[model samples]
Target: MASTEETKTAQVRIQLTTRYPDIELPDDPGPLLVSTGFRRYALSTLVNNLLQTERPVPFEFLINGQFLRTSIDEFLTANGISAETTLTVEYVRALIPPLHVSSYEHDDWISSVDVLSGSSPAVREAEEVSSGQERILSGGYDGLFRMWNMSNEVIATSNAPDEGGHTLAIKSVKFISPQKIASSSMDRTIRVWDYSEESATLTPTLELYGHKSSVDSIAVHSQSSRILSSSSDRSVGLWTTKKSEAPSAPENLIPKARNKRRKLSHPTPSKTGTQRGPLSLLTGHTDVVSSAIFSPTDHTVGYSASWDHTIRTWDLTTSACVDTRTTAHPLLSLAAMNGANLLAAGTSARHITMIDPRASATTIAAMTLRGHTNGVVSLAADPDSPYGLVSGSHDGTCRVWDIRSVRPGVGEVGGGQVGESVYVIPREILKEKGKSKAPVGGEGLKVFGVCWDKHVGIVSVGEDKRVQVNKAGDIIRT
Candidate 1:
């Protein structure tokens, strides 16, 4: 009689197809005889070896859309799979959850386009034009704002008239409509330009000048023509777009497009200014307010991050500050996540503090994320991507953090007392192309703005004067 192991083994015919396109493998290779063994690892190895051509590649197996992870015999037995059953399995590279980044998978990411450099230093911010994905707007420290086509080339070249653009370093840029854009600058003024509609050279239809200091950031309400702008003046101002007389500064607003100059007709003013002064100035933070955003869930409710080491939520209906709480570190940036019901705030300590706004009014972070070696100054929450949040730090790296993997545990570091009750989540790092990933670090070009979309991947700009767009994700092996 055969030994117990041999007696229990099943003779299964295994048909294989690689799910990873980047890690090349054979196409339609003949089936192999796989004996379902007591050891799951051995069966996994047999399939992996046959799927790989040059070297064995790591993979996860699924049979008939059902995932399999343990010993083959046990799994089959548990699933009521018979000994004579033929197993058709699909082999795929190991995967990190969508929107999440892993240290193990930078090789799969490719810089789809060569770095698109700007005319200035430190590309401060970037946003995809929602009306048309073909156009992307990039703001810079060189006091220039340029629009690029889908190909990453500057728009309005050789053919169409360019819009009225900023003259000073643009601190914030937001698209109000496909043809309309609002940009705030260090020049202490905001311009609302008719960016795409008219045929003639584009110029500001309205210029907003109310904030006493350079505006650091701006957010537009999803439901109305309202805007919230945070300034170095240590206050957040709320403004609305009211019908005004013709613009008095139309001539001053229009700048000669790069390499192409077109004179614009002085726009006859129906309004004297681009916008009326603040509907209400949210004043409380003792230091510069770095970022303010309308809550994605409720437009009337919004949050602001300040250098005062505090985050404040205000009621826009009354202009009243409703909640205030101090954080663990000086706040530099903020990204409000609706899906997770969490406020992701970047801090001076090279860490990210996620707060449950639904929690009591106390200003405590529910959990903290650490990896960067310098202050984290920018954060972008991928609404479509539930697995992660992207951060840009002073260390010149844009890191994607997988929040889905964080769990509560007990541990102590940095002089903070840890009790058995405290929950601790371990650390993860962002992987970079060409460079080996640091055990714990971010990846970027001395970033100022970081944004990611399912289709666009991660787009970052910084002191390097170049816009970097990385198509990050794993490819299937053929």
Candidate 2:
């Protein structure tokens, strides 16, 4: 007996195209007989199957110029696509380096999961607590510190004068602990906030004032209870999480020295008024200190960058500069790689330089990364990735870089170098009243701060007066 079995298949026509106008595709591939019950399948599979390529690299898919993230059958029905209707799927290359070294393939770096905007002032600095992903803290030029969550809602904000808030612009913010956060300000003070999750309260607990000028940046120890702050006073100050026992004492200001001086003194009481001073002071730079960050591996070592065009390594315990290297440009930001034996810094000239911590002590930068058209303002190492890093710049963009794939500087022809950006924050058009406004250049959206979470989620605050949350997708290896 001959039994005839019937096969059920759905038909779809795949079209390969790109966003660029000049990118022309080959002839349209014919129909594909796919299973109707298909749930989740790789977009590369469909592209390769239709293109007749033996191997295919990763690419994002769109249906009729609309981006699609689901399986073929589901995407077909949800969009009211019929089996007889040809599915116009377009593909675009993944911009980031195929992360092959990290045992994971990285995606979603080109786009953000959420864009948050409420306040109108540009954010100057921001921080995300790695232990908890919900809370995000940001400082703005409006002299405000705001806290928000994943829902694009402002959780709490410090805009009131009665809450022990800053009377001037907040410069930087860092988490002292999971429950406590500290912020430095242009007002020459650092305010510690006690945040409560259960009651949804974040209020100032105490204030620390030591720097004679505006405090620009701050760093917190990973394994200890210490905090490091840099200031326009051209000095780095070290303090602790403990509040001062005496509140009414005045600052015993240090005498101005002409030569390089590294000294540690007990936190002197403020002479101008009752305030907390730095427990130890590190002075060497001839100009404003832009950034200071603790080594991820060693808590005792701190790195500080300054407008003096030099990066100095500090022995926090001895209050001495162990090493210093002059840079080609004024260094503005820094990030310490935990285990790769490397560190990165952003410069005023729009360059990001990666150096061997052991080798940077005596020589020039090992390699320079070029991408942002404007000065780089912030840098952050991906905590989960072995060689991944992120940078924010005055060009109004955030880019991810992989140390393993950085092009060597052998092609320098004019005593200068050039590099490419892997992924860029896509330019979006503002939509109002059901009509899309003309696209505006990102020059006004200068990124001031960027941070990564334990899950590799990215959050960036920019001069656009916006906060963006970037959540990565599966690591798809080509």
Candidate 3:
């Protein structure tokens, strides 16, 4: 018998095309080229070898005087010949040419989430220090302003006499120093407390009573000792502490109820009386001033949001109104981000608007966020990450948003135009689903305030009358 290699003789064929008019080729080439009684064997031997080696096969094949480089896979797929089809080497080469092949895979998603504590507090506000530590200060119908340690434990609590019982309750609290805390109450006074000793003692440091109505909010300048307070009287007052020889008296600057309930007619100058008053009254809002805050980067610049349906920026140095933008709805909360150049304002309309103070104070609706179902009452910015912001709403939840993702470029989107929302953290909804059925403590949990701690992530307080600490991916129990 003949040797196996010699017995398995492979067929080889070739064909040339030069504009042939009358030629009938095989209906199914099957890796073979046949035309006008001419049979061309396929080139399967070289193709099989190249495919097995996982390499490209570059071979020149002639067809009608034109040369081309094609791959065996492409030639087979194009000719309706599948893997099961077997053809000789010459027939494959005559029917198709060898070529190079490239393949690619699809892109995948790489994003994740982190849930934190929730709140349903009547009022809440937080302040971060030059140090990385954060101070969460909040109050509600409970009539007490509680300060929590970074661990979410109540480090100190400031409460007035039960007789006083915080008549209107503590609306807001701020930290002027690590040992000093300032708060405004519905009782129409601003009290400063000192934590110098082991125990936290409440001292009536300053009685800012120019406003005839309840004091709504207060903000301390990062650089100066000046304090800015807004009130239901629709006025902003700037206060400065001074040392006096005689003992100071705590007095209600407002007149008795018999007198007209109008705002204080005469301005109260600083103690020297020679210099203008430390409390500069800004009078432009038609309605109550909902919130006021100093610029994080520039002490001379301040911002205020009001129920008057407008947001105003102030040049504190000149004590003049810098610019104002009227909104269709009342602004309930305001926060500054991106080194104080970006201002985020949440409205009663359940929409958040971001404004570039560096710009012409134009409203950038594109960057607006609309996730809260109810009115937003509180707004806080992440001190460590200016692009990160947390907002608390009467809707009983706090939303965390990443400002950077809202737009493509940095300066301003579409020349002061707003970009769409990027990310939102529905903290309240998450907490409700995670709560235990049986109450372990005296009262159930509810979130009142939401704040970002540089080291601890987000800290919050609620009607549950407890402070809860939350990191991005996990919730830290105090």
Candidate 4:
């Protein structure tokens, strides 16, 4: 019998295939024998050699929907795969990993982040500028929401506590328009602000008070001026940014008991705007509703993810919950991938689950992405591609994922296959002062929120009180 090394080096048969329209291989090439010792780089070289192109193109290989991160021999042994079986591998253009660009410091933990650039609703497409106009909106545990320019200067900040600003830690923030913003907080309310870029000022315009408990997150639809909020009270509230469009608060919906306001150093601005209420309350979640967002393709359709381990689809026009898909772990964050007709949910189990919320979808889940070492707390869909996604986790790392590269789950989760991240982005040390010098994987490094802007790249906030920016590489369309 041959030695262990020789047996491990034995060749295996593999069928090469690609879904990419541009890349093609010889028809009926049959199976090609390759050493089981081949890793990703070696396999990539093989493909480039076959193509015989002037310049070698890097490619990523996928077997069974999972990336080929290890040598063929190691992977086969670990999965108990037999060499006699012909493995079909899919190849696609490799994505360049995003590099750390810059970071902004905060007084306390940053909870949520969003970037506003020329692509925002208020900014006309014709007047849209790539640089200088980019603004960053961040909410923090310090009970203040701030607006920063591309130069990392604080252009505007929320009003004083007495002036209708958040009385407690802000949980979420979003730009309703270039001139307006909406924020939700543990103070049991949502607040909209009027921002003046010329004067670099932020003013409290409206106070939305109706949630019985802390408001966890908020999403905005600028076209319809609609806002969706998820709360600890287990309900999703619907409202409009335009004051005149919303109705009065119903007496029955407001709770009899309320959270006591916390005292602050600055005198509150004396409640500047009219207090408004939600147009409708969609209730069904048995636990805290962590996130809510309107469908990208249809404004009337909405979805909410809750700690109850379920994602509920709603008919917003009727204020009805149309369907619910249960998962194995509590969901902490959610993002819409309408281009792909899917919703991605970040879970406490340290993985992101992609669900097919469409009524005609045969399975509850399309696939599961596994990589994060801690709870996945935030998710942002790549604005350029439906299959592209990024997730922030308590493990102090952000992972970029391509849902298309996935493998079958073999029946562990209902209707769930599995995949791994395309790139792993880690927290970087800021060269500027007042930044954390904590080592990689240090404590108190949990990433709380993340958002991907087409113009500004990826922005993520974490317990380290830093708003980190990473410049994503150009997409190599295959």
Candidate 5:
């Protein structure tokens, strides 16, 4: 019976393909047959042998839009697929798990994070070569934003409220250029700053006054000089980085919500820079707008995720809400998958929904990614690949996901696929390192923001008031 069963063991046929231009096989190599026991390693070795490369490169394989994590026989059995069918396997460079490198402590809860890589567009345009150094910018609940160097040194700090900085906690921040920074705050204003690295000075350049409620987040298009901000007032503000291009605030402008005045660190006359107004105010969301971002390909189009349980598409050229897609839960964060034509929205329901915002698309959601134990608060698109995405959550972890590895919803009511994360990065506890740093917030370690940089693998900030760096690639040295 054992020998009879062995005789019945099937051989599967596969055809390999890749998007990588340099790494490829013959156009009509024909289908190759292999034993069902082969896994990723065995298949990878086979490809390298065919390429005849001096060095072997690790490869990941995908079949029918999902990664093949199991042996060929096991995968076929689990999916009820037949061994007689020829599989088209797409191979790509395997991504290594990110390693935790360094952490910088802050005074209060860190709300947002961004990175300016050595090879960023702003740096490249200046023709300045960075000696493998990247700058990190962090916004805090302490009503301040700070710039840090690779050595964990504080390079520059924003002024206090009395000295023209935000009077309330900053909610979002971004590096507009090497010399410019932008931040939105609970004070209901967006401030642009002139950063002088040589002098370690951060001076206020412009104060944008338009939103009637606290500004929740801000997105910048440096090349176009445009800024998009989300607010609790249920509107998105569209503004410019240049003051000369902005019009004066309407004289009839009124506050939407009443706020209390708090005692400042120093009571003095306000020095809050030059004031300006938004180019247009986008209103459509019925609930608090948590995030707003420009389209990955088209700057004239924008998307916003809100507590109203809807994701809206806006025509920036006409200041009109063009389309909206409703979801089951409130959305808290959003990011764009460049070249993939998809938007990822982190939801209060503890999962990220992959949305196809195209008008001609029939489905509301293309897929759903799950694994987080708490609300996913923030998301960052991978700079390395269009199919990759990273999310930070209140569950005290950041999850790395590959959109390509998805399957049809097993029990999901929605007519879409579902994906699981490739990796989960947990909050690093200082106590584990023999250091005594107590975490803040009721949950103690919820990640509030996350960003992926070309040079900086992944940067995450949380209720622990720490900016943690996770480095990937063989070239990164801690």
Candidate 6:
């Protein structure tokens, strides 16, 4: 029976062909006829050898009885077969499997947000208090001085008493104490206000009058009761608080500039009475002094940027000029950072210059920023990120710049390589669609101020009569 079965099986022979014309089968039938117990095993071996025969496998297939299917071409491709290359398998199992693929989708909006209010009517100046809360004192064209309670929702607005006066438009306001506020106005006087404990309301305490011109700016000493005010009269005046007393005669009001040759000349009364005197007269600039700020780190030192196209550092104790730099154009605003060592000034020329007060008073013109098409009106620095700065421009936009990589050059105070920008907030340009139903002459937005609150993020005020609060580039509230 065994002899009859072996004769009936009669050595099954097979020949394989591939799409690669160079691959060939061996001429010797001895190796081909070696009886591997499984017919599929012998077929798989032949297919793998054909794939490795120095020719690429255009396609792969498996054959068993009358069925044919594709195989996974691992031996040929090693990594995996791709769409461009076809793979085939040859096998004796009577069936083949189908090829399969898989399919996938991304998101748009920002993930999280934190919102806080900006100073209303556009904050003219903002200062961070030691308590981690911000003291943002703002002046409005409406002749009001408002103090925003950043810790609460409702902002406290207060007006100085009329005091036989009319329509006092506040031009500048500064915080002297938690209980006291000082403001300068078109009224040509500096009024100090005392706040009620719980009500957060302000009442006029005293009206100081020495500036011959309208007081344009005010700065207070962090440690002392003294106050400094700059005026359009081209002068900076220092004031000290005093208690009221009974009225007295106005005598000795003129000065006696006498000659030695003249005998026994009567002295003229001094024009400036004992009521006030400027500690020192800073007279370098020929134009109106616009802004003056005391260094937050050093009480004895301060800086002033003026419409005279110059910035000067002054020693408050001696009232002497320490350093000065002349701008190509009139400066509109000024900011000092890193303990007043690095100074930034914005000009009417639409350029921003960085300076080092301790170094030579030369402006680092190469470090100028030219993004704003209109004049830069204000600038603020991040409390946590010293290199991060936010600027508001008349072009109706606010931009954030990261200047962490900027470094000063050798022997140059503020002369350093320009930094790369990490973020920028573009101006929201409004498009006028058509003539129908549109207001006669209404233009779009105009940004008046931009400020960064440690607790609040970035806040911007515009001429559109809106205050926009943004956190991480997205407008959280308007």
Per-residue accuracy of model 2 over 407-460 as CA lDDT, tens digit each: 336764223223455566532222222434222334555677787654436667
- lDDT of candidate 6 over 1-478, digit per residue (tens): 1243443343323345433333433442222332212244445556556446463223223322112221122222223334233223332211111111100000111101112223321122452234434444555545665555454333556553333221455666666666677777666666666766477667665556566667766777635666777777777666654423312222232123466687544544322222233455565667878667667577677778788888888887787887777767787667666633677777777667776776663454436655666676677665544555777666666666644334334443245444433355533223223333212222344455565665456655545433445554322110
| RMSD (Å) of each candidate, 1 decimal | 12.1, 14.8, 21.0, 5.4, 4.6, 23.8
Residue-level lDDT of model 3, residues 155-251, one tens digit each, is: 5556554322345566667666555666676777666555543564554444455566777678775346677888888887677644342223323
lDDT of 5 by residue, 1-478 (tens): 1133452466799998987777777554778998777889999998888888798888889888778887888788778888889999988878888889899999999999999887554453754537656789999999999999989988899999878899899999998888899999998989999988779899998888899899999999888889999999999999998888998755334223323475323322226546789999999999999999999788999999999999999999999999999998999999999878999999998999999999998888889999888889999988877888999998888999998888669777477989999888877775476744333322788999999987877999989899999977684121
Task: Score each candidate by Cα lDDT.
Answer: 0.60, 0.63, 0.52, 0.84, 0.86, 0.51
Give TM-scores for every candidate, taking all chains together and pairing residue i with residue i: 0.62, 0.65, 0.58, 0.82, 0.90, 0.56
Error of 5 at 392 (Å): 0.3
Local accuracy of candidate 1 as per-residue lDDT tens digits, 222-301:
24777788899998977765445322332443332333355544433323234334577888889999999998878798
Q: Is candidate 5 or candidate 6 better by TM-score?
A: 5
Better of 4 and 5 by TM-score: 5
In lDDT terms, which candidate is top?
5
Sorted on TM-score, best first, the list reads: 5, 4, 2, 1, 3, 6
lDDT-superior candidate, 2 or 5: 5
Model 3 scores worst on lDDT over the 10 consecutive residues at 103-112
**TM-score (C-alpha, index-matched) for candidate 5:** 0.90
Please state the error at residue 313 of candidate 1 in Å.
Answer: 0.4
Model 5 bad stretches (over 4 Å): 1-8, 25-29, 52-56, 77-81, 119-129, 250-272, 430-442, 475-478
In angstroms, the error of model 4 at 144 is 1.3
Q: What is the lDDT for 120 in model 6?
A: 21
Candidate 2 weakest lDDT stretch, 10 residues: 102-111
